[model samples]
Target: MNNIEKIIEIKDLKMTYGDKEVLKGINLDIYKGNIIGYIGSNGAGKSTTIKILLGLVKGYSGSVSIFGKDIENENNDYKQKIGYVPEIAKVYESLTAKEYLTFVGQIYGLSYEKCDDKARKLMRVLGIDYAYDSRLSSFSKGMKQKVVIISALLHNPDILFLDEPLSGLDANSLLLIKEILYKLKQEGKTIFYSSHIMEVVEKLSDRIILLNEGEIVADGNFEEIKDSSFDGSLEEIFNQLTGFKKHNDLSSEFVSILKEV
Candidate 1:
């Protein structure tokens, strides 16, 4: 693909934490307007890779470019075009939900009226309108997650980076968020989402990148990956590719101990 058409490009990226290597010579190219799912087991370097791309982690050995701007040299400009939602939702405890969103909009250089209008619309769509004026410290986990999502989208960024976007969400809210993702994709926004939910990833992703122990084990569309691998669903394919075995050793050991008790 042409360089100009690509939204994110990583080349020979490497990151190490003390004695442990988190990412090892990873390369990826993400085009514009595509919803890409990043799937991996815990400590597989998915978050590390994303942090590098977002300029949150530094001192890595590689080249990363977002929208043709080098991350190392032009992070500020690139950051303005991207929105990020972390795995854990964090908001100002004393501030109301509307106040938090207003602050975020101001950081993005949006007018108060525009921010209020957009925040109300997003809160309504995400089913958090009733709690918009409540202090975030009193909100439930799912409610806080909705506020984070709304804040991330307040600026209508061209690229969105979401880490575990569905965490602490109800089934209805999950569906609503899924619909929002689809709508964003339709509007030609690039989304890079990380999650362990294989079923949801299979349904929503245009492409999937599987990582294992800081290395890429598989990368392709769901159909292509399945066709090239053993017969099964995405979960099965993932288990097979990542060498995950569902042994009952722990369960068996616990049951044996219970017999003695």
Candidate 2:
């Protein structure tokens, strides 16, 4: 992204909870139009880093800036330019799909008519408009996830953060979402995509950032890293960096334990 303005900057970020340190020290600079794949194993500070960027967790050491302004100083208005679909979407199951999206739009200061129009179009495109008036509690896991996607995109944000956005999506829906992500990048919107699925990240991300134990272990594209770390897939590379080598015998070990008992 030559000549593109920097959209995010994080330096020496650190966080702690009680006696445990979550994020040791993180440093990164993300530019406009970047499809950044942020990946790490469980408890690697991936969630903590994202929470801090979203301004959910304060009292962190180090500096973070988004849109050239210190994140700590940003107000609610700043959040308007960003859309976030969390890993676990906590929605009001009692509300109909339409009502839930409408409420979300209202929170972003959108008019009722505008929200309705956008919601209708998005739901239709995602092939879930038939469930529009249905209560979320009655929907399957995949259906509810579609609603969450529509709500996040209703405002046409400048930057999008998707944490495991494909968690419960079906094959068709997953393909559609992948295509949508490509389109978003084409439109010059910066995106932070976080997930444990290595294949998805490898194919979509322009650059990949690996985090381990609260620190960045690798930062590069798939090909850039494939040369040294692993000659093949992102999953292989991840295993290498994360020291997950024992998986080859896990099934055998389980079988042995079962037989013994």
Candidate 3:
């Protein structure tokens, strides 16, 4: 496909904090309607990449384009076409569920009636309909997460960037969120999600990108990585490709010593 057809394009992306480089010449492209999974260990710069795409951080030395516009130059128009759900769900504690989402929709330039209708539908799907009028401070972790998801979709953006979107969700909510993601993909919405959960990535992603120490280590489908002898399961392949050794081996030795006691 041509470059302009891609929903998200990153070329030679680089970022640094002091003398430590966080992103090292990263290059990636995500097309419309595809779910791309970004997997990496802690401090691997996954979140940094997402932030740069969302224009949350600037002064990077690469080019990033979303929906056919340069993120730097596009301004609000580009931002309005994308939705973001951060790893931590932050909401106004004093506002009710409906109230909070209404506020978010307004910021996206939606009318009050449209926002209310969309918010109500999303809340129902997220199993938070009963809490529509409840204050955010009175909601559970999962409830808060649902609110965040609802807010992200209220504007009906073409691209959704989710960072650890299922971090604090319960099992039911997790399944619900996954289903919702698949539905969105069916509707031709591009989704870029990051997480440490290998199984979920394997199941949900059309393609996976492995990052290690601010570098793209592996980028391909599961079968391709396995055929290259990376390993069988996604977890095994990730560890092998990223050169991550399990610290649990040390714990095993300690447990053996305790057994002798």
RMSDs, each prediction? 1.8, 1.3, 1.9
How well is each residue in 1-261 modelled by candidate 3, as lDDT tens digits? 563257888999999999999999999988888888888998899998988887789889989987767878875678887899998878999999889999999999999999999898878877779889889999888788888988998999999999889977999889988998999999989999888888999999988889999999888878876787666799988888777676579789888999994
Instruction: Write model 1 residue lDDT over 63-179, tens digit each, in one string.
Output: 998887787888387777789999987789999998999999989989999999999888998878998899999999999999999999999999999999989999999998999
lDDT of each: 0.89, 0.90, 0.87
Q: Per-residue lDDT of 9-32 in model 2, one digit per residue for the tens? A: 999999999988899989999998
- Higher-ranked by lDDT: 1 or 2: 2
Candidate that scores best on lDDT: 2
TM-score preference between candidates 2 and 3, better one? 2
Model 1 segments more than 4 A misplaced: 1-4, 254-260
Ranking of models by lDDT: 2, 1, 3
Candidate 3, clashing residue pairs? none
Q: Rank the candidates by TM-score, best first.
A: 2, 1, 3
- In model 1, state the lDDT of residue 34: 89
